[model samples]
Target: MDINNALKADPAPLGLAGFGLTTFLLSFVNAGILSGSAVNVVMPLAFAYGGFAQLLTGAFEMRRGNTFGFTAFTSYGSFWFFYAFLVIFNDLKIISIPGKALGIALILWGLFTLYMWSGTFRLNLALFLTFLFLWLAFIVLGFGSYYSIIELTRLGGIFGFLTAFFAVYTSFGIVNNSLKPGTIPLGPAILK
Candidate 1:
């Protein structure tokens, strides 16, 4: 079966929703709105929805020939998987990851996001804002963890909340538009 012809639905909404919800939950803990123990609930959700579901969405995007969606969904999905495993391993005492190392990893992710944000110019305002906030969140979180600064971490959490909001709004707009075209305005692309 030819996937390009067989797959018709847009998968971005699923990917965005998964990422947004997971980020929102984790950000709650990071922002100090919830206890760290809340991660016990978030871990499984990250593994199941954020990781697995986004991977599925990425595959669909590939079938649709959307390179940006494929990359974004797959990479972030892998990130969720990495996060879930990191927590699991730490809990099991299988391997210990230093805060500095985690911070460096996050900074690297931020670098990746920064480049990805450049691509959003050709997309829409929703994606532009989402990537912008996401990049900021990662950088702040990376610095916070690296320097053991609680305030930076909290600021990152605030950025994470903003990222999640835009992502969720984009997802909702996409889905709504699918059902009723022009029901939600995604705004014009910054680039022609």
Candidate 2:
């Protein structure tokens, strides 16, 4: 038996779902579809699916030797965990994070995501679009907080919703392609 030949399921779907669901839920809050207090509704999902499950997905991706999947899943997992902690803390009044601080964090994340977005040029269109929208979402959210603009936040929510939608679409593509190659088109890799 060749250990290298052992069957292992793809981890991308789980990672994408973790990202998509959490983004969708939080987008609702950001878009004002749900009250800001409704962030509580997202906390548990963030910890379970977005935090733990995506981290596990990243470990599996590492086992599969996919550096991008490993990095994206693990980093985003940590993002969800930290985000939940921040929300919970604020909800409980354990500490307060200034709007500027949150804005700075969002800007930093946007920069990081922008870097990742370039790498996705070598990937598929679906993933590339996902990162692109995500980057835009982060930028919009950052400016919203920094400027105290509700309209920007609402725009961010629209971009975030697109990001989540693309994530879900990419996840579906991964699963369907795995089950039956060419069953769903992810578009050709652009890099090469």
**Which residue window of length 10 is worst by lDDT in model 2?**
1-10
The sequence of per-residue lDDT tens digits that candidate 1 reaches over residues 1-192 is 886555887999999999999999999998989987888889999999999999999999998899999999999999999999998998899999899999999999999999999999999999999999999999999999999999999999999999999999999999999899999998888999
Please write out the lDDT profile of model 2 over residues 23-102, one tens digit for every residue: 99999999989999898989999999989999999998999999988999999999999999999998889989899899
* Residue pairs in collision within model 1: none
Model 1 segments more than 4 A misplaced: 1-6
Worst 10 residues of 1 by lDDT: 1-10
